[model samples]
Target: MKYDGGAQNVLSEDYYNLVIDQSGNKTAQGVINVANDMTISNSASFLTSTNTIDVSEQQRWRNLNW
Candidate 1:
């Protein structure tokens, strides 16, 4: 995943999770973004090659009025 904008305005909490299975047969990716809040929970058990998780970038907006 990639964001090309100048910044990412996340109003509240954000979370993500990823899972991969052995033999490189299964994989999963999850993302949670909310205007006010966000939450994510995940679990997995496996082993494989090229099974990696990465976060490109993150940015928050400033309260212009405050």
Candidate 2:
């Protein structure tokens, strides 16, 4: 997953529960997990490699007043 240029809020006082997971594979397999109030930005690459099996999971909330 890639986050461009933007503001992200993983946790807020009015919300609860946030989790993120990133995985990749080359000759071997690898994984990454982030929990609670995490933000990624600026063309970030979650899992990158030559033979990467790139994978990611994220959960969050946003308020839209319309």
Candidate 3:
């Protein structure tokens, strides 16, 4: 999902299993959590001088052949 706004947006830890695709201009207050099954595709940038990219990679295999 794409979060576009003028103010700073905060990404919660509740969305640990969600697929988030970032686009447009956005400002965040803290780090963004990347889930094991989640993928963040940043087509555009919303980074500032103070902002940082701190994403965690949780590697796990899913049974796609089921």
Candidate 4:
């Protein structure tokens, strides 16, 4: 918090943006959003020489509730 009160409470992240103007105006934007969907991700890469390349990918998911 600083003495200058031009704009307060501002936050910006990788996929989202937020701003609060001096007149109590708020602006928000998000590039990515996921709602009511199960999210999963997997990736694979090769780590062999130019002559030989080996790539493998596997995924395992487990959900437990009590």
Candidate 5:
């Protein structure tokens, strides 16, 4: 998914798995927090490229039930 120029996408701490296959410029003009077990596979064309992310906070959180 493309994190447009002004949108801050937050994947909050939850009990699940997230898998994403994206292409083009996945630029996070704002914060983009990808939680645990998130498998992000970019396209072959953008495979050698890196995403620009602005992390406002930590990506992972401790499970209280554990």
Candidate 6:
């Protein structure tokens, strides 16, 4: 999954499991309470992309995951 724009794009959500693999799959490390928006790319299994999702993470609304 990637955004249609470049730096103009932003991470709108921060509380869901995502897939970061070769087969384009969805991963899960359980539910984690996100305090702020951030890019979490790890090998332990956890999260996507767009306009090349290489973009940074940023939150917009609040308590959307709660």
lDDT of each: 0.26, 0.28, 0.44, 0.21, 0.33, 0.30
- Collision pairs in model 1: none
Off by over 4 Å in 6: 1-23, 38-66
lDDT of 4 by residue, 1-66 (tens): 111133232222221211121333222222222222211112211111223211122322211211
Top candidate on lDDT is: 3
Tell me model 3's lDDT, rounded to 2 decimals: 0.44
Which candidate's TM-score is highest? 3
| Span of ten consecutive residues with least summed lDDT in model 5 | 44-53
Tens digit per residue, CA lDDT, model 5, 1-66: 322232233333332433334444333233334444434454411121243332234443322221
lDDT, candidate 3, 1-66, per-residue tens: 445333335564434443334455444556555444533345534543565544445553232212
Candidate 4, residue 54: Cα displacement in angstroms equals 38
lDDT of 2 by residue, 1-66 (tens): 222323332222222332222222112123233343433323332332333222234543221211
The TM-score, computed over Cα atoms with residue i paired to residue i, of candidate 6 is 0.21
Q: In angstroms, what RMSD does candidate 5 have relative to the true structure?
A: 10.5
The 10-residue segment of model 4 with minimum total lDDT is 39-48
- The better-scoring model by TM-score among 1 and 5 is 5
Worst 10 contiguous positions by lDDT, candidate 2: 19-28
Give the lowest summed-lDDT range of ten residues in model 6.
1-10
For all predicted structures, in order, the TM-scores are 0.17, 0.23, 0.37, 0.15, 0.29, 0.21
State the number of backbone clashes in model 1: 0
Candidate 1 regions with alpha-carbon error over 4 angstroms: 1-15, 27-54, 58-66
